[model samples]
Target: MSVDVSKIVRSHEGKRGKLISLLQDIQSRYNYLPREALEVVAEQTGIPLVDIYGVATFYRSFSLTPRGSHLVSVCLGTACHVRGGREVAEELERQLQIKPGQTTTDNEFTLETVNCLGACALGPIVVLDGRYFSKVSPARVKQIIKSARAGKEEHTADGHVFPVKVSCPRCNHSLMDFSHQIDGHSSVRMTMAFGGKHGWLRLSSLYGSFNLESEYDIPLDTVVNLFCPHCHAELISANVCPLCGAPMVPMLVIGGGMVQICARRGCKEHRLDLNGVNV
Candidate 1:
């Protein structure tokens, strides 16, 4: 059924400030940029439909079509590339029978590739359902997609799903409060644009070229702190840990730990030989 653009737009009082918020709310309700909703947004804001669409499309965050039940994203960032991100992504596309920008016919899954997710250390990462799976490989891609399709289990890299409460490293406040990934894997769309956090991870994929941004100039991806070095323990971003309650220290720990270096076997966490002693 077509969306009632006028009604929806009118529902929002002509408060210009509330336009963006209203659109976000509406898009959330429909899980897409409904034609009717766009009409409403355009008419209410006195903005041209073309302008509205332009805004929506310009931002990588917005979607124009209905999303699938599950979202699957493969990282093509630099670290992931060095670790075979392209291969993993290709494998996914082959299995899903859909390209990066297309959704499956049944709406079961939508597959896309991102330049990076700020987990460069976790190259070749795959985020399914908003959960990050690092060091992904062709084999792992198969398993991840299978698990998601099954819906009977929560697929995780290294075959382990730790109940970690992810948060922003800078602000100790709850990160989930500001998190906007809608259905995890079903909602994320990846684009390779220069001067973004994923620039390093997107060097090879020159789908389109533009002025190159500086290495450090780009926006750094989310910094995850207070995570367990081992076991992928869910740690809170507080000074005194939430689970252990120990004085939290910022440690560069991702992919579970040294044993589980990343989601890939090649980068499997290993014992560090410090001073000839296995530490």
Candidate 2:
């Protein structure tokens, strides 16, 4: 499996502050950052190999070693721990036959334990390929693994789509527009600006659904800035999208958590943090 490190490097040739993005692209292509890829990146970009390694190690998302096709992360944070999180992890280990931080012999799955995924309210959470499973149990672990083995997409009993009501993180004003519904739920309304065009955008309030309507045609991969329609405060969060390294647009989940979606058009990376834990 030879990776075209040169082509990857050429894509970001003159772009400043693209090291993380460059590494992300490399990892996305190979499933993990190969040592040869890193070396080639350093040589092509004139960045020291040590610096590249530093960037790789600094972010837990970047992996220097080979990873399995599917990633399974079990939360062991205080909230999850109290809710039989350990038991869930043990069940995953039993089913997958791999300990934490180890990949299965078949390279199908890798198990990992993280301190927190910021969704403490949904304790005993298991994240498979960035999809959050709330209140995961030992029995559910088997189903999840089975689904992964069969390469079948897992959907909740009700089609895996659930509605959420969000407010502007800064102004606390409700962003839900009942007058305009999407996916049979109130749409999340926000003002957006991209490519010198400013207009209103409505997003499906469903956490897992990607249906959205924008005033302007947003080109795929284009990054947009989002603002609260009420207070007009920018909704951009400091956190970057784990999937595409794009700026995350955050909305306060009405009850107790925050939901963030990638600002880049067509990137289906969204996060739900019910307990507001940073990590």
RMSD for each model, in Å, please? 17.3, 8.2
Q: Give the Å shift of residue 15 in candidate 2.
A: 1.1
Candidate 1 stretches greater than 4 Å from native? 1-16, 155-279
Off by over 4 Å in 2: 1-3, 157-195, 198-279
Best by lDDT: 2
| TM-score (C-alpha) between model 2 and the true structure | 0.65
Worst 10 residues of 1 by lDDT: 270-279
lDDT of 1: 0.47
Number of the top TM-score candidate: 2
- Tell me how candidate 2 scores on lDDT: 0.77
lDDT of each: 0.47, 0.77
